[model samples]
Target: MRLSGRQIDCIRGGRGVFSGLDFEASSGEVLAVVGPNGSGKTSLLRLIAGLLVPAGGSVALEGGDAELTLPEQAHYLGHRDALKPALSVHENLSFWRDFLGGKTGDVGQCLAAVGLGHATHLPAAFLSAGQRRRLSIARLMVVRRPVWLLDEPTSALDTAGQALFVGVMRDHLAGGGIVIAATHAPLGIETRELRMGSAT
Candidate 1:
C-alpha cells in the first residue's frame, strides 16, 4: 500500500502553516515527520488523517480498503491521550475496540503487551503520564488499522516504555502496516524523514 500527499497546503487559525508539500510512504515503512516548532509537522499529520481539511492538495492511499476513506483506515494518535478518566484501563480499551469496529485483537493481550495488564481495572484518572501513553498504545494494538498517524508518540514514555513501544511498532510494520509519526525524539526504529519547513 502507498500513502501519498501531493502539493499539500495547510492553514490554521487564518495563518498559513505550509504549502506545496509532497510525501509518500509505502507499507512496512515509517515516515518520521520532524521539524522545529511551528513548522507544521503535526498539521501535516492531521491533514492526512482527515482531521483538518487541507486548504489545497490531496492525500490518497493506494491499495487500501476501497470501501473506507483514509481516515477510516487510519488511527490518529494525537497530542492528547483521548482517554476517559472515569473509565478503567480495560474499559477504555474496550470502548475503543467496539467503537472502531475493525479487525479486533484481545484487549487483555494488548494491555499486557503494553505493560498495562496489572492496571486493567484502574481508573484512567489515577494513572501516570507514562501509563496513560501506554494505554493509548494499547488502543492501537487492540484495533487493527493499516495507517498509524502518531504525534509525539513517545511523549511521557519512560526509557522502558519507549523501548516497548518500538517493539509494538515493529510488530505493526511486520504485519504490513504503515506508520507516519511526528516526533522530535528518535523513534528508536529505522525511518525515513519528512522534514517540514517553517510556516509560510
Candidate 2:
C-alpha cells in the first residue's frame, strides 16, 4: 500500500505552508520531515494524517482506499505524552487500549521495549520528562497501526531513548508500516523530504 499526496496544500494563520506539494510514502518506508523551527513541518504531518485538510489539494492512498481521518488507520504521537498524570503507567496504557477501539497491544512487551517495564506501576507524574517520552513512545510499539505521524519524537529523550525510538521505527518499517515524523535531528530512516515554504 502507498500514500500519495498530489498538489497538497495547507494554510495556517493565513500563511501558506506549501501548495502544489507532491510526495509518496509506500509500505515499509519511513519518510522523515525536517525543517527549522516554525517551518510548518508539523503542519504538513497533520495534513497528511487528515488532522488538517489542505487548502486546495488531494491526499489519497494508492489502492483505491478512502481518505483517512485524524485517528483512524493512523497513530499520531505529538510532543505531548498524552498520559494521565493521575493514572499509573499500566493504567494509562490500559485505558488507551480500551478507548482506542478495544484493540489491545502487548503492554508488557511495549513497556520493556521503551525501557519502562520497571516503572509500569508508577504514576505518570512520578516519571521524569525523558521517561514520560519513552512511555508515550512505547504506545507506538504496542499499538498496531498502518501510519505513524510523529512530531519531535526524540525530544527530551536521552541517548538510549533515541536509540529505542530508532529501533521501533525500524521494526515498524520492517512490518510494512509507514512513518512520517517531523524532527530536527535525523530520524534514522531513508526519507523523501518535503520542504515547507518552498515553491510547492
Candidate 3:
C-alpha cells in the first residue's frame, strides 16, 4: 500500500511547525525526512501515525480517503527505544508479536538479525545504546506493516548495524512495504528526499 499526505499540518506548543506539507510514498519506495533538530520531523511521523492530531489537512492510506489509526497498518519506531526495561529481550519481542496484530516472528531470528541473539535473555536495561536500538528495530521484522515510521533509525548503530538495517529495509520494500524515516545521514538507501527545514 501507499501513504500519501496532502496539505498536512501539525502544531505543537501553539507553534506552527509546519502546514500544508504534501508527499506520496508507495510500497517498495522510501521517503526520507531530513532537517535540523526541531524541524518537526517527529511531528510529521506522529501525525501520520495518528498519535498527534493535525491542525489541518490529511494523511490517507493508498487510495483510501480514511485516515489511519494508531497501531493500525503502520509500525512506528521512535528515537527512544520503547522496550520494557525490565523485560528480557525474548519477552519483549514475544509481547510485541501479539500486540502488533500479526504473525509471531522468531525472536531468535530477529535477535540474530539485529546482532543481539546473545542478549536475548538479558534485560533491556543492561543493553548498550546501540544494542537497544537494534532491539527496537527487531519489532519491525516481527510483523510486516505496510508503513514503517522510523526516527533516526541509525542513530546508535555502527557500520554493521546500519548495513543490517538497510538490508532488512530493502527486503521489506521488496515485499511491498513502505518506509518513512527521519534521519540525519544516509540510511544506506537512496530515498525520495523531503526537506522539512524549509517548512519551518
Candidate 4:
C-alpha cells in the first residue's frame, strides 16, 4: 500500500501551524519526521491519523483495505502513553486488545518483548519512566495495525529498550507495514526523512 499526502495545511486556534506539505510512504517503508519544536511534526502525524482534520489538501492510501478508513487502519502512539494509571499492565493491554478488536498475539509475549513480563500484574502508576514506555510499546504488539504513527516514541526508553524497539520496527517493516514517526532521536533503522518548518 502507498500512503500519500498532498499540499496539506494545518491551522490551530485560528493560527497557522503548517501549510503546503506533501509526503509519501509505501508499504515496508519508514518515514521519519524531524524538526525543531513548533515545526508541526506532531501536527502532520495527527493529520495523517485523522485525529485532526486538514485545513486543505488530502491524505490518501492506495491499494489498502477499502472497507476501513485510514484512521481505523492505523495505530496512533502519541506522546501520551494512554495507559490507565490505576490498571495493571496486563489489564491496560487487554483493554486495548479488546477495544481495538485484536484477535491474535499473546499478551504475555508482547509484554516480554518490551521487557515488562514480570510487571504484568503491577499497576501502571508504579512503573518507572522507561517501564511505562516499554508498556506503551507492548500495546503496539498486542494489536496489529498496518500503519504506525508515533510521536517521540523513544522519549523515556533506555539504550537497550531503543535497540529492542528497533528490532520490533524492523519486524513490522518486514511484514509490509508502514511507519511514520515524529522524533528528535535516531530511529536506528533505515528511513526517509521528512523535515518540516524552518527550524529543522
Best candidate, TM-score: 1
Please write out the lDDT profile of model 2 over residues 1-200, one tens digit for every residue.
Answer: 78778887778888877677777888988777776777778887788777787898887766423554434777889877899999999899877766664345788888887898899998899999999988888777667777888998888998878887888888888988888888778765577776555533
lDDT of 4 by residue, 140-160 (tens): 888998899999998889999
Error of 3 at 26 (Å): 0.7
- Using TM-score, rank the candidates from best to worst: 1, 4, 3, 2
Expressed as tens digits, the lDDT of each residue in 84-120 for candidate 3 is 9999988888788877765457878988988998989
- In order, the Cα lDDT scores of the candidates are 0.95, 0.79, 0.86, 0.90
- Model 2 has an lDDT value of 0.79
Candidate topping lDDT: 1
Q: List candidate 2 segments past 4 Å from native.
A: 63-70, 198-200
lDDT of 4: 0.90
The ten-residue window of minimal lDDT in model 1 covers 42-51
Candidate 1's residue-wise lDDT over 1-200, tens digit each? 99999999888999999999999999999999999999998888888888899999999999999999999999999989999999999999999999999899999999999998899999999999999999999999999999999999999999999999999999999999999999999999999999888877
Find the 10 residues in a row with the least total lDDT in model 3.
62-71
Q: What TM-score number comes out for model 3? A: 0.93
